[model samples]
Target: MQRTTISVSGMACDGCEQNVETAVETLDGVNRVEADHTADTVEVVRADDVADDDLHAAIERAGYDVSA
Candidate 1:
């Protein structure tokens, strides 16, 4: 498994955190997801084959910005 920490913007509460987690958890190979609105970060534990772009896209689709 690979763990990735992604910086994200626009998360303001636990609901935003949950939105991000739910989004990322839907991707194939994603084993776990944790989002911290206060930290503006999301940590994902996923299979090595999972692309970072997919993670970014998932967060974006859920209505947030993924930082580079």
Candidate 2:
């Protein structure tokens, strides 16, 4: 498994964090997801086949801004 952490904008509460986490967890290679609105960050534990872009897109699709 690979762990990736990325900063995100627009998360204001625990529900926002769950939204991001749920979105990322839907990806095929994602093993786990943890999003913290208080910290404005999302951490994903995924399989080797998961690409960074996939994570970015998943977060964005959930309506958050991801830092590069």
Highest lDDT among the candidates is held by which one?
1
Off by over 4 Å in 2: none
Task: List the candidates' TM-scores in order.
Answer: 0.98, 0.95
Query: Tens digits of per-residue lDDT for model 1 on 1-68?
Result: 99899999999999999999999999999999999999999999999999999999999999999998
**Per-residue lDDT of model 2, residues 1-68, tens digit only:** 99889999999998999899999999998988999888889989999999999899989999999987
Weakest lDDT window of 10 consecutive positions for candidate 2:
29-38
Off by over 4 Å in 1: none
lDDT of each: 0.96, 0.92
